[model samples]
Target chain A: MSIEVNNIHRIKPIASYIVVKVLEETKTTSRGILLPNSKESPQKGEIISVGPGKKSESGQLKEIDLKQGQVVVFGEYAGTLIAQDESSKYLLIKEEDVYGTYE
Target chain B: MSIEVNNIHRIKPIASYIVVKVLEETKTTSRGILLPNSKESPQKGEIISVGPGKKSESGQLKEIDLKQGQVVVFGEYAGTLIAQDESSKYLLIKEEDVYGTYE
Candidate 1:
């Protein structure tokens, strides 16, 4: 694993949780208007690390399907935001909180 | 199933989604301070209906452990709120968005 990947695991998310690095969104819209950072919009991020799945009714571990490096879309305010560093932040979201994945 | 249960099925939630009826929280705290409806706090709700689980990486449908009538705790602003009727409303959340279930 690279240094960036290793840094993500410093804080391990538990129980079907995933750590994602929010990707930088496009600053300009199709109309060439620059979107402000304060704009409210759905977010996309790349999975950095994932926890073991939550237990099922029968005590089996239900696996999360998302893999590391996969980009996923989530609602505008779905998960808890954690500041990993002055220059970066990460989101802690359950696997199912992800609405969809980018192909 | 009772009529209420049947009524909940009118809208079938899909893909690990669940329909939850927000419960009436305690109006007064243990110290007897009245809590206003506008006060923000984590929410608790009973599962009205649950959709089939999301698909796994292997293409199999994963299973959700929550059952009908089960009360679950969720974040303060976790899911989309849907009005079911004039006096009733429901929330649509993915199974993993549920933090815990009351036994």
Candidate 2:
């Protein structure tokens, strides 16, 4: 279990959510949550990876269908969660803390 | 000492920067820093505020000039800083963590 690749890849996690890492058990969401900063993260998880968006300014890249493992609900005050690992359940929210994406 | 206006003013905080409230005394330079989450917040403060645009998809609103009190550098992981105030400085980042705007 080793994965940490980077080629200066870190838009800093605002490329737009689609980050899943639960593997199983799912049910206890407040929806995408990430709001905290004083020096680098304050909490993390809840918005399981998401892509298909962000780059819109005419640079044209606007396309969100919420796929990459789906299961969202963000906006407890959304955006700002980083826990790339710890089996704590990978997280890094944005895309407006998702707030709407569920089955 | 009371200020908190809103018309559902909570895209969570991703409508694009421009939010000042320092009083007087600047120069810490960490740029626009924000990140962390698990519940609601993890830390907060540092991104005085800035905005000029962000609303594309042909709805046309792409302009990002970073004003309203410019002094940025967002990207300590880019975006997520909420403090509102308490002489605490007022934080709420997510303009791509601003990472470039200083003078």
lDDT of 2: 0.42
Top candidate, metric lDDT: 1
Worst 10 residues of 2 chain B by lDDT: B26-35
Error of 1 at B75 (Å): 24
Predicted candidate 2 versus true structure: per-residue lDDT over B1-103, tens digit per residue: 3335332133234457545333332222123222232333222223444555677756677655445554443333333333344444444565655423333
A1-103 per-residue lDDT for model 2 (tens digits): 1112121122223345444343333333467554344433223233433544667677567766666555665543444322233334343455664556556
Best by TM-score: 1
Alpha-carbon error at B85 in model 2, in Å?
7.9
Enumerate clash totals for all models, in the order shown.
0, 41
Question: lDDT scores for all predictions?
Answer: 0.67, 0.42
